[model samples]
Target chain A: MRLLIEIEVRFGEFVLSVNESLTLDGVTALFGPSGSGKTTLLRCIAGLEPRAEGRIEADDQAWLDSKAGVSLPAHHRMAGMVFQQALLFPHLSVRKNLLYGWRRRGQRPGPDFSEVLDALRLAPLLEQRENELSGGEMQRVALGRVLLSAPRMLLLDEPLAAQDERRKAEILPYLKRTIREFQLPVVYVSHAVDEVMPMASRVLHMDSGRLQSSAAARVSGGTAFGAILLGATLQRQLDSRLAVFCVGNAEVIAFLDSDTPNAREVLLAVEPRDLVIATGKTDAPLNAGAMDCTVRSIGEDETSGNLVLELAAGSSSFRLEHSFARHSDTVLRVGQKIRVLLTQPARVASPIVQSGTGRDSA
Target chain B: MIRAVEVIELDSLWLTLRLASLSTAILMVLATPLAYWLATTKAGIKPIVEAVTALPLILPPTVLGFYLLILFSPSSAFGSLWVQVTGQTLSFSFTGILLASVVHSFPFAVQPMQTAFENNGRRPAEVAQSLGASPFDAFITVTVPMARRGFLTAAVLGFAHSVGEFGVILLVGGNIPGRTRVISIDIYTHVETLDYASAHFLSMLTLCFAMLVLSLVFIVNRRYPIRT
Candidate 1:
């Protein structure tokens, strides 16, 4: 689905004018500082702010058309939003809160009721009240509540921003799993780069009420130039400091400097600026994962004055950007074998695809 | 002493109850929408509307009564229209006193409700709307439940104020024996006739009823205190 939005609103000293057309599929993270119109943009999309004059179209549905004088109110917009707080009704029990939105779906087909309960791991907390649940638990229930409503596009406005580190760690994986399973266009606002890197396939960077940059976080097919997400598995967990992952059969010994996912299946993110490339395999340090790959393409970034090298290791291809002088090392070629060392472990992300129900394997 | 004037007391008591009940019910219905608008709308004329609604509170009862008397006289347009429609003059009638009481107790009904709506704010309604409730549905389901204390206070205050009304009712309805002789007017008549026994009894009754209404408001408010 695609969304075209152009809206302007003024509040005392600040005037917010944002105009952008976005492809609203694949989890897209909206990153910005506070008071940067991230929440306002979501509010406009949800029709919570009616006075905003703009045109918004989601797929074929025109949510707002100013010339035709069409502005749907919040109730008619059919967006299932999970707020930063108030994930569920405070006055209701967990069961009642779920049922409230579940019954409102009317005749639309959505994720099955049992599937949401199992997927969000909310069965144990079904009888509990919202206050009884922890922050992470409430966010999970919030996701379940939204799924029950069968939204066309999910809008989560900083869902995990209020939680502590442990709670955030507990809740983010469920969001990642939800995105993977539903594959709906999920637009969420977040401030942390670590959270954005693992989950969002696309990132829209905003500043001063405008989209500064937009890119595909994955390889080849998006707008911004963020870290590329790769699908790899934890092939071996030999010791505390070392874990081996088969990124297509070249056993990559990734240093586990911190907490790593216990699940054998994990996603690894390698940033282009973090990798070191040499024309030949060298005496690499103990803490870094070194790779032997044949270079596929080389180009210089006009803005950064860095040589952008695209290399292929086994079946996966990745890019690296490094500053270059006129004469530094041996000349690089298109098909030359080179060793790449990553001093920092590629951050371990949640498993890309998990069982869609009853996830006992956390 | 009580048995000697029991019949008059009963008649006056019944009339007062009927007038207060009718006035309170109609006032609540009419004031709810006005209070909601006043609480929520950012319209420029809100202060003007509030000033008009509050006029009855500060204006002397005699001044209000004098104007209402003129307004209900058959020589005036509204009085003549009422006479033409009902085949009776509006002044010196039961309906006249009822209308006068509604005007007198307008603020009592509206102020508390307006305060409740403003205190309740727009968040609950907005949340309900996102959960698939229309505007009116949200008002009834979320707004009303959260503002129940305000409703209770407004209703009790309106009912009690109408029950104790004397000056405005006397001016509009003229203290007819079985028609407009409410408890306060009956007490006034007893005092004028030097019948201290009946005056004391009816005065005590009004005091007790007022106490009951005030106590009910306080208890309800205490039971369900607004939590943030």
Candidate 2:
């Protein structure tokens, strides 16, 4: 499914204008700074912003059409939203809040009642009141409540922003698992790069209330210039400092400098500058992962005057940026074969289960 | 053991209770929508509507009574319409006093409810809608339950204010024993006739009742510790 949107809203001097058709394949991250209309865009999609005008079509259903004067009310939009604050029904118990939307689904098919509880681990907290749950637990329950509503699409506005590091660590895995299991088209709004890297299969960057660009997240994650190796399972630990991961079709050896022994699976993020381009295979050090790649295309960074090369490795593709002077002697073509080295140690993210640490840090 | 004069005094007290009960019931029904509108509307005339609702809070009861009396006179449009409907003028009647009490107690019924809605915010209602609840369903299921304390406070204050009304009732519904004579007016009658003994008894009773009502409010407020 895909979403076709052309919306414009004006709040005094500030105007938010967006025109894009997003392919709702996986998690699509709306990435931007705090005041850059990321949340506004998400709100517009959910039919929460009444003043927003323009056409929004999800598949063939028209959610909003200004010229036709058809603006579906929020309840009829069939878009479930999870806000930054859990905003659970304080008067209701955890079980009631979870069942609230499920009971209101009105003949629509939804997730099984018991399965949602199991997925979000909400069975234990069912009898508890809203105030009794912790931040992470509350957010999980909020997500579960929205999921039970059986919406066509999910709109999340910084669902984890209110949590501290430890709470975030506690909730991220459940979020990842829920999205994977539900397989619903999700528009995830967040300003943090670390968050988008781990969750987003595509990123739409926004700035100053205008959409900047939309980039595909090949098989794994990240935008045009960054790479996130998702679902990289641990092959084996060679020593205290060395480990191997099976990323896609290649066995990549990674350097582990921290205690991540309990990380059964990890997400590895590599920035644009960390990838090194070499015309011929170089004798790389033990700490880096080197692979054969074919240069798909090359372009210049307009702002920094650096050459950015789009490369394909096995079934995955990524971009590598380098200063123009560094590669002045070599001529590069669109389909030239080359070798790329992951020089820096990719930042290792939280494990699916953190075991016992980082839970009560706050 | 009961004297005839005490029986007459009891009748006035009974009249006061009936008036207070009816006024409180009507105000609650009217205030729900008015308070909700005041809390959520962004219209330019919101301040004007708010000021009108709160006029009774600041204006002296006698001034409000004077205007109400004029409006209820036989020559006025509303008074003439009332006369045509019920074959009597609005002034000097129980219905007239009831209307005056509702107007006098308007702020007491609305302010607490409006504050509650504002503190509860639009987020909860919007969240409810996103969860598949219609607007009215969200209001009844989520908004009302969340702001219950405000409703309780408004009811108690409105009831109390109507029970304590004196000047407005005196002007709009002229003192005619058993008809317009409420407890406050009855107490005034006792004092005017140099009947200090009867006046003291009724005054003490009202004082104790007021204290009990206020204490109930304070205790409930302490237990719940309202959401700021």
Candidate 3:
């Protein structure tokens, strides 16, 4: 539940310096880009990367402390790691692969064979060889194989990267189900924001190996397929198109992708380019997906001659980019009151996070 | 002359098989872990250990045989100790030739096994460990299975090299009939005595045996191709 990780590892010239403590009880997402050392952080936590020097404590247990010369090996650390590539033992059948850990653990704290077989729905694929399984099936078997060995923590390093979109969509729900059903703390590494929006209770934004804690992602009903989502309570549904909701005391209208949920609030992800900001208002109605906002900062786009505006609307903030070359009506400044608009209709997601973590709170 | 050559061939063939098989079996037991260590260890002395293991590959057979002859003689400390323990002279014995053959063929056995273990990579073992297996358990279960081809190559190479050995065994074993004179030495002795037919016969047998073993190795490698 509680983890304190402080480590400095050098891989040739690329030094990964991480000094942060985390509470990873329920699906904590390590959100970062490639080469940001997200995988390295996971490896260091699992005690697989020995080049890192520092102290790590999980649930009152000391997993690593370099100054004290106490470094537990990966096996003794009791953590299950899933790599990006499905690293199933190709020599063994799926059943044997699962049992490799079961036999090693032998009545340990982890789930038994029958339980794992049932939970992962691996009954049909037991006799199949690793090579025979599809990419998604192989990854599921790998996950089950790791889970069979009683582990104190779960570290998934972009487990869906190798899979196609359909495979990724297929496995993601199962992953969320596993974490919830088993109640295991997970440190998930991913570069995609939409991927972790529904499952991760807490989000840690990482860049260049530096970790910064973000808002609570607290997914209530396991939904992340939304293209554009915001934390809003369902004030009520007027028709299908016109629905009003409260985003931190600001009444806003949005176009929903599906039927309005019985639950109160819903969330989804939207692209930055999809959002448009108008410097001067021209009688655009509030029901047309336009909300009043204070302009925080405006910067020029050197690449495309477009102007980017950072706007804030009652506890929520989102960036909007516009072409100043075409609409150079007035000069924009910091802290200017303006109206922001969503040109396209956004699908409101079912599961919502309260207050939204790092939804441009800055 | 034909009858004499057949008799020598039968005796020398059996002796060669016994020596090669015994040395290879013992080396397998000893070298599995050693080669694993050599493959995985990040120690500062790894280069030195590697160089020592490879010495037999390039060292002159006569040079190695001369050193073994001195080391096994009763005048030397090792030879005296061996004599005291076994109640037999270390030099001019079957045990002496066995010892020399093992040293001469050490590189052939260890190199392939070591390379295989190295090529297997540390990821598999690390994966095993993360699955709650101890390091030793991971090595035996995961690493060994992955490196089986290397082991196969090592065993066949060691057996064949020991079977074809000549100079080292001769120097240490002194050409004792029915005891230390393996097939290669038998061929050498026959040629020395100008017994051309006997030499040719034994040489042909050994050549065919080596070629068969090597062919088997190639077939196994081609079939499995455990590189990935």
State each model's CA lDDT, in order.
0.75, 0.80, 0.75
- DockQ, 0 to 1 scale, candidate 2: 0.44
Candidate 3 ranges with C-alpha deviation above 4 Å = A215-362, B1-7, B76-89, B211-228
- Measured against the true structure, the TM-scores of the candidates, in listed sequence, are 0.72, 0.77, 0.75
Top candidate, metric lDDT: 2
Model 2 misplaced regions, further than 4 Å? A216-362, B218-228
Best by TM-score: 2
Between 1 and 3, whose DockQ is larger? Answer: 3
Cα deviation at A236, candidate 1, in Å, is: 25
Clashing pairs in 2: none
Residue-by-residue lDDT tens digits, candidate 3, B1-228: 768757878999999999999999887887787798899898999999989988988989989999999999998999999999999987999888888888888888888899988887888888888987888888888888888888898899899889888888888888888999888888888888998888888888888988898888899778776533
RMSD of 2: 10.5
- Please give, for residues A1-362, the per-residue lDDT of candidate 3 as tens digits: 67788788887677787766666666776665356688888888888997889888877788899989999888778789999977887667899889887887765677778887888789999999876788899899998999888788899998998888999989887787788878788888775556765566555656566665543422211111112334566676668676766665555565555544555555544434445556555655544556677777676656666665655666555455567423776867789787656564444543442222212211
Candidate 1, residue B190: lDDT: 92
Interface RMSD of each: 2.5, 1.7, 1.9
Per-candidate DockQ vs. reference? 0.24, 0.44, 0.43
Tens digits of per-residue lDDT for model 2, A1-362: 76788999999888999887766756776655447788888889888898899999988799999999998888888799999999999989999999899999988987998888889899999999887899999999999999999988889898998999899889999999999999888888864556665565555666568774332222343344556555566787778877777665565666674755455566566765666676554866678776677788787767767776766766556555578424568888889887777786565543322211211121
Q: State what share of the real interface contacts each candidate retains.
A: 0.35, 0.77, 0.67
